[model samples]
Target: MKEKNLLKDSSAYYENNDYYEIFSKAEDGESKVVNYLSKIAKDKIVLDAGCGTGKFLQILEDVSSKYIGIDLSFNQLVKAKIKSRKENSIFVNTNLKDTMLCSDSIDLIVSPWVLGTITDLGDRELCLQDLKRVLKPGGKIILIENEEDSEFETLRGHDKDTRTKDYNNWILNNGFKVMERFNTYFKFDSKDEARKCFLEIYGVEVASRVKSELIEHKIVLFEFVK
Candidate 1:
């Protein structure tokens, strides 16, 4: 499948009410990500890459000076618009590999739970480069990826251990400093519950395998300073 098409399909799969409700509840890592960003992003121009349905963007509305959400899915953006009524917030339908925003224009870049599913390493690198280009000196990039032992292994069909170190190395090589690297896990009531949510959002077989690997579902949040 084409890269863009894969993204679109993924978005469509998560576009259902079940997934949206799961996200809205902040039952996953969304709340933790939002809380961390809100603490450090006060009065800054924030860019939310792959800002699906503006869930994290909504959390930054009051905390950030300005917020721009960019995602590849128009349907997700539509849902975001319905959820957030803030006129100051802008949601743009654009690929992260190529953003319309200019260079050195943003203060903070936040990407939550996005890097893992982007199987195209080149596209992921391009997106990071675009983020770096648009960020001002001394800016920050808050990225969240799935923990190596998390359910995300099945969702993305890739292991985090394979490319996570390289991703961090790339950030350091590109002039960003890693400030904090920690593993955070979220627990569901049962494997079945987790599997159901995963299946509704991703697919069936993947969800089944992911559930089998669940000791406790979790993700890793990486905070970088540029």
Candidate 2:
């Protein structure tokens, strides 16, 4: 019943035999962020706030004019460094809520799967403020977050995607605009992997009914023009 410190780093799970077995090939959620960032990151200085395992490192570095990946996890940053080869791409270990970057210095700031940690709109506002501080005026910030989840996400600990309605209200109140929305997946190569993931996240009874097929993951994108 022990839980991984998701906030600590992906390597924790990546190293765990059981956790890794279940999730090793569990999903392609990262592609959604990379796909979007790759399109607009050309020759732009892009910031990946929660760049887990440096998943976006290769593509962003190739497409971006300059890329900076930051995360609180030292382990994750290590992996990021290994994936990046260009002098233009660098990884920093720092908290997204606050950073040392100078004001209006970055051209593009992309934060994906980070805000879901904030359960409160007020708290989310503070996070946005920090990103806003460094973002150049009229620059773009693309935010990716999970929508309301169903019971299928049972094994998840406190990390279930925050309620969608609350997030929607927060966006509306803050005057951010939706640029795109879509349904994606946490895909598994096989049923066994899916079953293990379900069991690890939800437990035995929940895993019992989990189909081998990929599970649907709903995501929304918000584009804030500063």
- Give the number of the best model, judged by lDDT: 2
Best-matching candidate per TM-score: 2
TM per candidate: 0.75, 0.77
lDDT of each: 0.66, 0.68
lDDT of 1 by residue, 107-147 (tens): 99888767645767788788888888898988878776655
Can you give the lDDT of residue 84 in candidate 1? 69
* Stretches of model 2 off by over 4 angstroms after superposition: 1-26, 29-33, 119-124, 149-162, 198-209
TM-score of predicted structure 1: 0.75
Candidate 2 — which pairs collide? 43-65, 138-226, 155-201, 155-202
- On the 0 to 100 scale, the lDDT of residue 133 in model 2 is 87
